[model samples]
Target chain A: MQLSNRLIKWLISGPPLVFLLIFFVAPSLIMIVTSFRLPGEFGGLAPLTIFSEHTSIDSGLTLETYQFFLSDWIYLEIFLKSFFIATLTTIICIAMAYPLALLIANSPRKFRNLMIMLVVLPFASNFLIRVYAWMIILGPESTLSHVINHILGVLGLEPVTLLFSPFAVLIGMVYVHLPFMILPLYTNLEKHDPILLDAAQDLGANRWQQFWCVTWPLSLPGIFSGSALVFIPVLGMFAIPDILGGTGDIMIGNLIKDQFLGTRDWPFGSTLSIMLTIAVLGATVFFTWLARSVMRSP
Target chain B: MKEIADIPEKTMRHSSPLLRLIAMLVYAFLYIPLCIVIVFSFNDSKLNAEWVGFTLHWYQTLWHDHEMLLAVRNSLFIACCASTSATILGTMAGLAIHRYKLKVLPILAFTPLAMPEILLGVSLLLFYLQVLNLTLGLLSIILAHTTFCIGFVAIIVRARLQGMDESIFEAARDLGATPWQAFYHVTLPLIKPAIIAGALMSFTLSIDDFVITFFTKGIGEPILPIQIYTMIKVAVTPEVNAISTLLMLLTLTLIILASRFDSSMLRDPSR
Candidate 1:
C-alpha cells in the first residue's frame, strides 16, 4: 500500500516538475551565467578558455558588463525615464478607473457582472490591434489631430505632432493597462460594507468627508495592488515606445531589446535584464509593505 | 445607456452626476478606437485618412496575400500544440498541488505568469541557442508558449478544485475503488468545466502573444502578429485593418465561449 501510494504521487506530480525544472529553472540559470561572460567576436558568448601557442588562458568570465552598466549615465537615465513613465501611467489609471469602479460596485447586483465584463471585453482583443488603433487616431491626418492642430493654430501656438510623441505613448500605456486597474479596484470596493457609509453619514459627515474618511482609506490596498500590476508591466514594455513614441523615446525595455537584436551584445542584454528583475522585485516589496501598513493603520 | 438605467434608484442617488459622466467617458475611451478599426476595414481609400466608400477590396487583398495566409497557418498550429501540452501538464500540476500540497510546484508554475514576459523571451532565446543549439522556429516557439501558459491553466483548475467537496473523493475510495478510479469518476467529472475554460484561455493567450514571440521567433517564419507589426511599421493599409478586425472577431468568440464554461475565469488571477 505504501509503495503504491508513492507511485501514485510520482505519477501525478512528476511531469510538470521535471518540465519546469528543465525549461524554466535551467534557462533562468543560463541567463545569469551568460550575464557574467564576455561578448564573443561576433555576437554570442566567448569561449571559456583560449589556447595560444605558449599557454592556455582563461577568458571565461568578467564583471566588465556590470562595470560598463554602472559607468554610464545613459542607462541610469533610461531607468529613471522608464520609472517616470510607469508612475505617470499608474496614477492616470487610478484616476480614470476609480470613479468607474466605484460606480460599478455601487450599482445593482444584477448589473455588476455586465459592467465588469464590459471593462474586460476590450482587453480580450488583440493587444497589437489596440496599439495600432492609437496609431490611426493620433496620425496627423486623423480627425482628432486635425481638430487639435486647428485649435492650436487659432490660439497662435505651434501645431504639435501627436503621433510619435510621449503623449501618444502615455495614452497607449494607459489604454492597454486601464482594465488591470479597474478589475482589482472593483473587486476591493465591492466588498466594502454599506453600513459603514451609512454610519458615517449619520454622524453628520458630508459626502466628500465620508469618502475621505471611510471609503478612500479602505481602498488603499486595492490601489496599491492595481498600481503594482500597471507599474511592473509598463516598466518592461517596449512595444508602446517602439511604435508610438518618437525617436527620442527609449525605455529600458527598448534598450535591452536593442542589445540582443540590434547590437548582438548578449552579456549586456542579460545584464540589463537582471537589473530590470531587481527593479521589479524592489517595487513589489515596496508595494507589499505599503499595502500592509495602510491596512493596519485603519 | 440601458445599463445605467438598470442601476437601482438608491444607488443611482449615491452616484453623482460627475461620477456618471466620468464613467461614461471612460467607457467611450475604452471602445471608440475598436469601433474605428472595424469601420475602416471596408474603407475604399488607400490613405485611410477618411472614408470614401465601403468596399471589400481589403478583405480580398488579405485573401490573396500568401505571406499572410502562411502566418495564419503558423499561428493556429502553434496555438493548438502549445495549449494542448500546457493543459495536460498544468492539470497535473493543479491536481498535485491541491491533493499533495506540494511546496515548490505552485511557485514554479505561477512565477512565469507574474514575471515580465520579455525576461522569459530573452532567457529562452539564450538557452535554445547556446545550450541546446536548436534553431529558432515553430517548435521553439511552441515550447516557450507552453512554459508561460501552464500557469494560467493551473490557476483556474486549482481554484475550481478548492471550491469542490473533499467528501466525494473519500466516498469513492471507501467504495472499494482504486485511487485512479476515484479520480476518474468523482474528480474529473466535477472539474471538467474548469479544465475546458483553462484550455480555451491558454489557446487565446498563445494566439495573441507578441512580446515573447518577438524575441523567441528567429528569422524566416512569418507569424501573424509579426506580419501585422511589419505592416504597421512599414506602411499603413486597409488590409492591416481587415486582418485586425477578423482577429478581433475570432478572439471575441473564443473568450465568450470560455466564459460560458466557467464564469469565475473572468476574475483576475491576482484575486
Candidate 2:
C-alpha cells in the first residue's frame, strides 16, 4: 500500500493544502490587503496614507483612515475597555471553573457524567438565545437583583447590583465559558496518580504547602490550556457584553464589530482587528514563554 | 502542574466542606440566570421579569409566529445539510491525512483551529461577496458551516481511526473483500461511534453558531440565533425566555447523545 515518497507526499498534502491556501490563507491575505486599502466613509477604493488632501489615493496612497482612528479618543477608549473586559471575563471563568473541576474529578461516575453533560449543554444553545436569556435576567425589572435583595434582606444586608455592569458581563462570561475552563482542568486533574498525593502527604508537607508545591505545579498544563480556551473566546466575545453590559463596558470585539457594521468604517475596523490579533498573539507568546521558563528553571 | 493536584491528597484526611460550598456557589452563579429565563418562559406578559402568572401562550405563539418559525426551519435545514456535508468531507480528509504521510497538510488543515473565528468570518464574507460576486442565503450559510464543522469531524474521526487495530481491515481484505467492502463492513462499523459523535457535534455547532453566521447570513434570512438576536435587541421578553428554555432542553438532549457516543468512540473502536 505504500506509494513512492514523492507521490505519497503529493497525495497526502497537496489537495488539502491547496484547498486551505485558496480559501483560508488567501482570504486572510486579501483581508490584510483590504485593510491597507484607503477607505471611504461611504464606499470607494483608494491607496492608504495620512494628511495630504492631495494624498487621498485615487490610484495613490493615503493614511487618513489610520490617522483618523489613531486620533479618535473613542476608538482608543473602546480598544482599552475591550481588553479590560476580556481579562475580567477570563478571571471570572477561572474562579468559577476550578472548584467545579475539582468536584467533578472526585465525584461518582454517574454524577460526573451528568455534570459534564450539564456543563456542555449550555454551549450548544444558540449564541443569540444564550444572550437573550441573560438579557431577561439582567433587564431593569429583572428578578435576579430582586431575589438577591430578598435573600440579603434576611441577613440584614443590601443586595448588590448584578445587572448591566461589567459585573454582569463577567457573570455572563463565567456562565457561558465555565465548561471550557472545567473540561481541560478536569482532564488534567483526572490524569493525576492517586498515590502521588498519598506519597506527598506521607512526606511532612503542610496542606497549603502541598497545594502550592505539588498540585498547582502538575495542574499548570490544565490551567494554561483552560486559560487559553476561555481567554481566546472571551476576547472575541460580542454577544454577551452587548446584551448584558451597560454603556461603560466594551471590548475589542465589540468595537471592531461596531466599526464595520454600525459605523461602516472598514479601514478603522481592520486596524482595530489587526491590533487585537497582535495583542492575542503577544499574550499567547508570553504565556508560552512563561510556561517554558517555569519548566526549565530547576 | 503537580501542586494543585497534590492539594486534595494532603487535605485527604479532612472533609472538603469549603470546596463543596464554593462548588455549590459557582453552580448557583451559573444556573440562576438560566432559572430566571426558564421561569419567565411561562409568563403571559411582554414584561419578562414582571410575570403575569403562567400561560402556555408563548408556546402557542411559537407555532403562530410565521417569521420566527421560518427562521427556525431555515436553521434546522441548514444545520442538517452542513453537518452531513462536513462529516463526509472531514472524514475523508481525516482518512487521507492519517492514512497517508501528509507532513505539511496537518498544519495547514488545523490552522483554522488557531485562527480566530472573527478573522475567518470576515475573510469568508469577503470571499463570497466581493470575489464570488454572489449574494447567498441558505446555501452560503451551509457552505460556511461545513468549512468549519469539517475540521471538528475530521479530528474526531481520525482519532477513532487511530484507535482501530488496522489488522481488521487486513483480515477483511484477506477474506476476499474488496478495498471498499473491507472499509464499509469492517472499518466503518468499527468507527461508528466516532462518526455519530462527529456528526452530532457538527450539528450542535451549526445550530449554535453566531460569529460566522453573522457575517455570511444574508438579509431577511434569519436563522434561530439571528431571530433571537433581533428580538433581544428590541427588548427582552418572556417569549424570548421561552425560546431560550426550549433551546436549553434541545441542546442538553443533543449534548447527552453526542457525549454518550463519544465515550464509546474513544474506548471501543478496536472492539
Candidate 3:
C-alpha cells in the first residue's frame, strides 16, 4: 500500500516537473551559460572550449559579452528608455483602470458581468492584430488623426504626425495592457465590503478621506499585481514598438531581437535577455516586499 | 442582501458625472479600435484612410489567399495540440499540488507566469539551436507554447481544486473503491469543468502567441499572426483587416464557449 501510494504521487507530479525542468528551467540555464561564451567568427555563438590552448581568448569562455553591453552607451540608453516607457505605461493604465474598475464593480450585478465581459472581449483577438488596429488608427492620414489634426488646426497649431512616434508607442502599450490592469482592479474592488465605506461615512469621513483611508489601502494588493502584470509585459514588449515606434524609439526588447535575429550575436542577445530577466525579477521582489510591509504597518 | 442594497447607495454617490464620463471614454478607448477594424474590412480602397464605399472585396481576397489560409490552418493545429498537452500536464500537477503538501511545487509551477516572454523565447531558441541541435519548426513552437501555457492551466485547476469538497473522495473510498477509482469517478467529474476551461483558455493563448513563435519558428511556414505581421510590415492592406476581423470573431466565439462551460460548471455543482 505504501509503495502504491508513493507510485501514485510520482505519477501525478512527475510529468509536469520533468517537462518544466527539461523545457523551461534547462533552457534558461543554457541561456545564462551561453551568455558567458564568446561570439563566433561571423556572428553566432562559438563552442565553449574552455582552457584549451588552441582556442583564442576572445573566442573562448569570457565576460566580453557582458562587458560589451556595459561599455555601450546605446544599450544603456535602450534599457533606460524601456524602463521609462514601462513605468509610464503602468501609471497610465492604473489611472485609466481605477475609475473604470470602480464603475464596473459598483454597477448592478447583471451589468457588472456584462461590463467585465466587454473589457475582456478585446483580449480574445490576436495581440498583433490589435496592435495593427492601432497602427491604422494612428496613421497620419487615418480619420482619427485627421480629426485630431483638424481640431489642432482650428487652434492655429501645426498638424500632428501621430504614427511612428514615442507617443504612438505609449498609446499602443496602454491600449494593449489596459485589460490586464482593469481585470485585477475590478476583482479586488468588487470584493470590497461596502459596509466599511458606510462606517467610514458615519464616522464623519468625507468621500476623499474615506477613499484614501479605507478603499485605496485595501486595494493596494490589486494595484501591485496589476502594475506588475502591465509593467513586466510592457518591459519586454517588442512587437508594439516594432509596429508603432519610430527609428529613435527603440527599447531593450527591440535591441535583444536585433542582436539575435538581425545581428546574429547570440551571446550578446543572451546577455540582454539575462539583464531583462533580472530587472523584471528585481521589480517583482521589490513590489512584493513593499506590499507586505504596507499591509503589516499601521 | 440589505447590506448589498445600502452598499450601492453609498457607492453611487461617489459615481459623479465626471467619473461616469471618464469611464465611458475609457470603454470607448478599449473598443473603438476593434470596431474600426471590422468596419474598415469592408472598405473599397486598399488604404485604410477613407471610406470610399462598402464592399466585400477584401474578404473575397482573403478567402482566395492560399498562403494566409495555410497559416490559419497551421495556427489552429498548433493551438489544439499545445493546449491539449498543456491541459494534461497541468491537471496532473494541479492534482498533485492540491493533494500533497509540496512546498516548492507551487512556486516552481508559476515561475513561467513571471518570466518575460522575450527571455522565455530567447532561452528556448538558444536551447534548441545550441543544446538540442534540433531544427526550429512547428515542434519547437509547440513545446514553447506548452511550457508557458502549463502555468495558466495549473492555476485554474488549482483554484477549482481549492474550492472542491474532499469528502466525496473519502466517501467513494469508504465504499470500497480504490484510489484510482475514487479519482476517476468522483474528483474527475468535479474538476472536469475547470480542466475544460483551462484547455480553452490555453487554446486562445496559443493561437494568439506571436513573440515566442516568432523567436523559435525559424525558416518554417508562418503562423497566422506572423503572416499578418509580415504583410503589415511590407504594406498596409485592407485584406489584413478582413482577416483580422475574422480572427476576432473566431476568438470571441471560443471565449463565449469557454465561459459557457465554466458557468455551467459553477451552476451544476452536484454533477
> Best candidate per TM-score, number?
1
Please rank every candidate by TM-score, starting with the best. Answer: 1, 3, 2
Give per-residue lDDT, candidate 1, residue B7.
40
The sequence of per-residue lDDT tens digits that candidate 3 reaches over residues B1-271 is 3334445465554477888899999989989999889999999997888889999999999889999999999999999999999999989888989999976667667887776688889999999988899899889999999998888788778878888888888999899999999999999998998899889988988998989999989685768878999998998899999999998888888788777767532221111
Could you give the interface RMSD of each candidate, to one decimal?
A: 3.4, 4.8, 3.6
Cα lDDT of model 1 by residue, B1-271, tens digit = 2344454354343478899899999999999999999999999999767889999999999999999999999999999999999999999999999889799989899888777889999999999998899999999999999999988889889999999999989999999999989999899999999899889999999999999899889789999999999999998898999999999999899988999988987766344
Give the TM-scores of the predictions, in the order they appear: 0.96, 0.87, 0.95
Cα lDDT tens digits, model 2, B1-271, are 3333345544443228888898888767666767777887887777876768889888888778888789888998999999997787677777777787666566666666655677677677667765676686898888788877777877888887888798878898889986678778988888788888889888888888888888788887878887887777775556677777887787667767877887743221111
lDDT of 3: 0.86
* Residue range with the least summed lDDT across 10 consecutive positions in model 3 chain A: A50-59
Across A34-108, the per-residue lDDT of candidate 2 in tens digits comes to 666666747534434443455444634446666777887987787677667667767777777877787777665
Across all candidates, the chain A TM-score values are 0.96, 0.83, 0.94
Candidate 2 or 3, higher TM-score?
3
Candidate 1 stretches greater than 4 Å from native: A50-59, B1-14, B269-271
What is every candidate's C-alpha DockQ against the true complex, given to 2 decimals?
Answer: 0.53, 0.39, 0.55
Clashing pairs in 3: none
- lDDT by residue (A64-87, candidate 1, tens digit) is 999999999999999999999999
Off by over 4 Å in 2: A1-19, A44-74, A108-111, A147-162, B1-15, B101-104, B170-179, B264-271
- Give residue A202's error in model 3 in angstroms: 2.0
- In order, the Cα lDDT scores of the candidates are 0.91, 0.72, 0.86
True contacts recovered per prediction: 0.57, 0.44, 0.68
